[model samples]
Target: LAEHVVADSVLVPGVALVGGGPGDPDLITVRGRRLLAAADVVIADRLGPRDLLAELPPHVEVIDAAKIPYGRFMAQEAINQALIDHARAGKAVVRLKGGDPFVFGRGMEEAEALAAAGIPCTVVPGISSSISVPGAAGIPVTHRGVAHEFTVVSGHVAPDDPRSLVDWSALATLRGTLVLLMAVEKIGAIAAALIAHGRPADTPVAIVQEGTTAAQRRVDATLDTVGEVAKAEGVRPPAVIVIGAVVAVGPDQQP
Candidate 1:
């Protein structure tokens, strides 16, 4: 296959954006694992199934391309340049990210950069935490006769931020589920916005931290108190915040 593929010029040096899947190493797709195993170099983010990195062969060069939204990390330009540089050198480069690369993972930006630089790129979709995390906690993002739709948004910035694009008022009017990733830091403000925008103060909320891993823990509260409860419980980043009645439909719910 290797020689036959080379004869047709089908196999070329390029970058693969592989989604590691919500934190669980086993959740990664088969294709993603295969590409990861064959990669010559891997640029990984802080999230995702990081434990899998330890399993890589000694010859596989690993680069820490972690970019924490509000924290110190590598610049996006540098990460793109790294992929271009490595692939141009005839190496199989893998850009491993947590969850689906296009789901707020900045995979598109990297792909565009690679394309502009004349490098080939492939994307491997992974399970996003927006749904998986809630599911891991036994809470379905969408439940029949409960919630028929769900919306996932980034809470990296407060709703009041000038650069923020989310319309908190519209979100408040949504009768479906609202899943907020990276909102631990701004949960207080987000919850306040939702409540102020018309969401009931008593709307059910669930905050799942380090979801899908052994360290997972959940804190339940209402929209009025979720932020304070999350802070008091020491919920940190990398957690998923679920709002709406669907949160009350988890397997552990009481009658």
Candidate 2:
């Protein structure tokens, strides 16, 4: 039955959740590139390698999956429905996302939805921005004898938010590296929380904006000063915040 299903799937339409890597179009895996080139329709998020979309054939259809229409963002249910609808109509659908599809990109949710609807789905992994973004700024997430372990967390919610799963106090005591995503808007509160919990105010921090792209820029500061430094520099979203001794290992670090 399994072999028959696999063989039968070849002739049926399916969904491919392809990770576009960290902003750079060339960084995408060969398999991902081939799949993108063959896709009949693509549903793309704002953060992926958008340049690749322009390279698609004129017959391919593209949809902005993340666009906010009429002051409201497109719901996840709607996105899933669009994918199922397109695939059922015999079109090869590619749901392209930035970075790794599983790393906070909610690719699993879409996969589950497709499964429930009896649609075949495949996942292609991409390099997560959690690691590549820091590397783009010359900051290694883990260095030899410097940082042995690294933790990646989403800073979209304030430390004090009731829905937050992270323990700010516990994170403060950890000696390893901490990489934060979507935290630019709440850096002040997050920085204050770390300091209040016991992380030294002098801990080195690096913020890499638009990492891995030509527009990439790096800003260095201490834990206590990162908030103000980022604000003064006009650092925006789609940036990565790296905090630890590893930040000092970068070539751009100051004495």
Model 1: per-residue Cα lDDT over 102-201, one tens digit each: 9999999999999999887788899999999999999999999999999999999999999999999999999999999999999999999999999999
lDDT winner: 2
Q: In candidate 2, residue 114 scores what lDDT?
A: 95
Q: In candidate 2, how many Å is residue 5 off? A: 17
After TM-score superposition, what is the CA distance of residue 180 in candidate 1 from its true location, in Å? Answer: 0.3
The candidate 2 region of ten consecutive residues with least summed lDDT is 1-10
**How many clashes in each candidate?**
0, 0
Give a tens-digit lDDT track for model 2, residues 29-139. Answer: 876787787788899999999999999999999999865232442588888888888888888888999999999999999999999999888888999999999998899
How does candidate 2 score on lDDT? 0.89
Which regions of candidate 2 deviate over 4 angstroms? 1-13, 68-74, 251-255
C-alpha TM-score for every candidate: 0.93, 0.92
**Which regions of candidate 1 are displaced past 4 Å?**
1-13, 67-74
